[model samples]
Target: MEKMPAKQYEMGSSTSTKSMQPQKFLHSKRIGHMDSFSRHEMMYDPPSMESKSMPRSSYFNSSKPWPDLESDESDMENEIDIDNLPPIEVGPHEHRLQYTYWLWFSRKGTHRATDYSKSLRVVGRCASVQQWWSLYSHLKRPTALHPYRDLSLFKQGIKPMWEDPANSKGGQWVIRLRKNQIDRAWENVCMAMLGEQFLVGDEICGVVLTTRSPECSLSVWNRTATDHASTTRIRDTLRRILNIPVSVPMEYKIHCDSLKYVAISKGPLKS
Candidate 1:
């Protein structure tokens, strides 16, 4: 893939692109913790307790619309006697992605005192369709996590924090939603990123999900803060794919300003 030149934003710049790949960005560039005013709209939840020791069905939410994973497929075309049945074959059916991505889990705002660098954990890395689904299926949903926890997804080797080299000059588009709103929106954004449906260049780095008591925010980090054209392209794609209501408000901010002003500032950050 051809690398695109990223736009750099100095400290205190107002212009930034809108995004929702989520945990929050464009507002906390330094990385120990995220500012409330962080920009984004996508959400993810950590793996369920059982997922770690023993993988379980990914769809833990009883309210989930789809049928259970076990019973969806049935009825074979050919029939054979039990005594002489043909042996099954195992082949490589996994679908591959352009980049191997990593999923991160942490409790950023819920326990502000905890060290962000230390708490961030990589659940796993995936480069194939089967691998992605296997990882996602075992994890818990956003609604299942504690209000203070967060989830993030990014390309392998790229940390989701604002201070990471890949994200320093970039910004994100943030989307805020009530606790009840993260389900479908989260899934949509994941699919979009994995599918590379955003239509922009390699500008997108990753996305994050931050959950607080009352609501949560989803943010998508891009590689540039001043590339207005590319940023707008991503924003439009996000808007269309997310089906965000016209009435909902969106905001953009740069990592430099976020790090310099949002973080290390005494004032309370906005969600």
Candidate 2:
């Protein structure tokens, strides 16, 4: 037979046999141990406690405890006790609400309004130095009070007005501050009042702040208007405490004069 031309076979020809791939086998875990495990015990048993060893302080070797260490531990226990204890319910008085009195009047009017009055008002102690601060901090600032409000911290029972028996024969050492000066003047005066900086402490009845259309003034009222020594001492002391200029004169208006002016203004007007 004549040799026919050899046919060229292409790579990946259909005539080529397909290679067989090896199969993978998965082995089962041993079933022998499965019978030993108990699901209920595994799920339900309590966890083991953490292995924290007791400190040297807890060791029973020593009969007495170290003072410093014991104190710290006691403090910690106290803190824990405090934290666990119910919070105390504080009352209004326990919080210490305080009020101050002030005398306010119009120069041209008869009716003067005062925060100081005979009516019983809740006033914290005005006796000691610290008590004064307590009053100041808890009470409203002078400027924050109503325009008609005036604060007078006098010996208890003495009224703030000139008509008071204690104030009848007296006068006031007045310092005039402009409208713009109200805030600073109030602060300075309040500080002076609280600090008890007046020299004639016995002569001083109380302090007053008068608010007017154009200006506001503060005065330290004294029991005796004619007593120059007392007046001079009070004036000098107030000036020093307020750091006012020596040249600035503080006017002394006798309580008598104040009452008279009020009387005349209130008197029936002649037609």
lDDT of 2 by residue, 1-271 (tens): 0111222111212211111000000011211111222222112221122322222122112233222211324323222211232322223333211222322222222233332233212222343333343334444444544444344566544667788898999988777655544555554455455344554556777776766545556778889978888888888776654556564545677889777877788779999
For model 1, the run of ten residues with the poorest summed lDDT: 71-80
Identify the candidate with maximal TM-score: 1
How much is the lDDT of residue 6 in candidate 2? 25
Q: Please give the distance, in angstroms, between residue 151's alpha carbon in candidate 1 and its true position after superposition.
A: 0.2
| Candidate 2 positional error at 40, Å | 74
CA lDDT for candidate 1: 0.59
Which number leads on lDDT?
1
Clashing pairs in 2: 101-151, 101-152, 102-150, 102-151, 102-152, 103-150
lDDT of 1 by residue, 31-132 (tens): 212212112311223234244443222212122232221221311211112233222222265445667787777655423442466556555456655556
